[model samples]
Target: MPNKKTPTIWAIGDVQGCCDALQELLNHPEIKEDEHAQFWFAGDLINRGPHSLKTLRTIMQLGERAVCVLGNHDLHLLAVYAGIRRENKSDTIDEILQAPDVEEIIHWLRHRPLAHFDQNHLMVHAGVMAKWDEKKTLKLAAEVSDALQSKHWQKYLQKMYGNEPNRWRDSLTGSKRRRVIINALTRMRMCFEDGSMEFGSKDSPFDNKSNDIMPWFELPNRKTEKTTIIFGHWSTLGLMIRKNLIALDTGCVWGGKLSAIRLSDRKLVQVECTGKRR
Candidate 1:
């Protein structure tokens, strides 16, 4: 039987380590009025802003009340921790790396889902592929999660980067299969007409001057078109809400507002961010 008392669900945009803004949003009167409110973080929980450690710890303390999908930056953090990647100059995860609870933090982060599905809504850090429906998306995401949690996780992370095989194929196996899944679920923003993922564009789809590319969601005949997708990661796309899609990344780390939506009512709430752009 379903629990009749499920708490209010708030879908939040990327925090990008702006812990102060996140705190203010959490304490907003409308949100604070509900004692058992649940939070679904769209990812990039840390990086490129002040207080990565505090932001991560704040979410961690939420325990069962929080659900977070791993973003590209989050995966980059794991790769760096595994010594397979170097920290970028814009990265703000060093404080987390230097924390005494670093090991625990990494363990928790690696175990976070790449996608989450509940109440007919699917949430990912980025976009889903045109060929993938909700079930297949969850299955593929679980495969990556299994790899991340396995004893050979570091070896898997080592093989995780690359832009090849930018299109998904059912025949894809091993690291190639994992890479496609990771890229689609965590890094993808735009796609070519054939539904192949494009990694280079950071511009808003409306502002995209190219004729050959379109935002992944606009692809025709998308298998998950009937399922609402709530995602972040493309801050340049800002906040977009449509019948079957909601984009919540509002560039919080770039000094834009941190946004959130109450799922049941689609009520929007936001807090202004003062963080500097990287």
Candidate 2:
């Protein structure tokens, strides 16, 4: 008998509806070369690129071979589908919203977890809170996931738009708590030293910054510091590979490369984008 091939897991950066770029990255010699490959997407699978429908379909078709966490854009798509929010001018998700399989696709996307952990790697679309250990992070993530899959999910989406109560607190309750969890897991880029999220900074970390705001991952004495955290929401921060954190959003929708990193060996594979979103 032939030797059983070990599964090779690839954590890919945000695709953001750039299906062509995703396909190109998948076909790269490093990725396609592995017959037993699995993919973990960092999220924002749709919006602001050339092909939202194809992107969602392709990832949906992956079934057991792919794991996706929800990102801000993903939630926006769900909000629009639920009639809780209007489509933005930059959104390219109309194809997905109008598809024959729209219901099925939305169901799949809505059910996706806010965080996923496997083999000691914690994956979220954005940063996990400094106060959350691996177990707490997973637990808090489930709270939002439950809300999204609940019958009253539309009600939750209706109240999901603001940035109020920007810090996490154990005493937080109801939709406010879920909203904070969703924002931290899907949209956070920077935070204050106390782990309260900072919404105003989107520039790369290389840019000048006040001492008061630091990247969420860099918060002092983070609880999840020991676990390897994989995230993708900050496209401007690009690809940052550190001892315990990976930031993989290389801005494929903005004409940057689509990136993927192999889990076992940390090999990097990338495909350059052909055009910027108009």
Q: List CA RMSD, all candidates.
A: 1.2, 1.7
- Scanning candidate 1 in windows of ten residues, the lowest lDDT window is 269-278
Candidate 2 structure quality by residue, lDDT tens digits, 1-278: 99977688999999998999988888898788876699999989989998889998888888888999999999999999999889988889898888998999988998999999998899999989888999999999999899899888888888887898899999999879988998899989999988999899999977935998998988888999989999999988999998888889999899999999998889999999875684
What TM-score does structure 1 among the candidates reach?
A: 0.98
Ten-residue stretch with the least lDDT total in model 2: 269-278
Clashing pairs in 1: none
Off by over 4 Å in 1: 1-3
Model 1 error, position 246 (Å): 0.5
For model 2, what is the alpha-carbon lDDT of residue 144?
87
Cα lDDT, all candidates: 0.94, 0.90
**In candidate 1, how many Å is residue 238 off?**
0.5
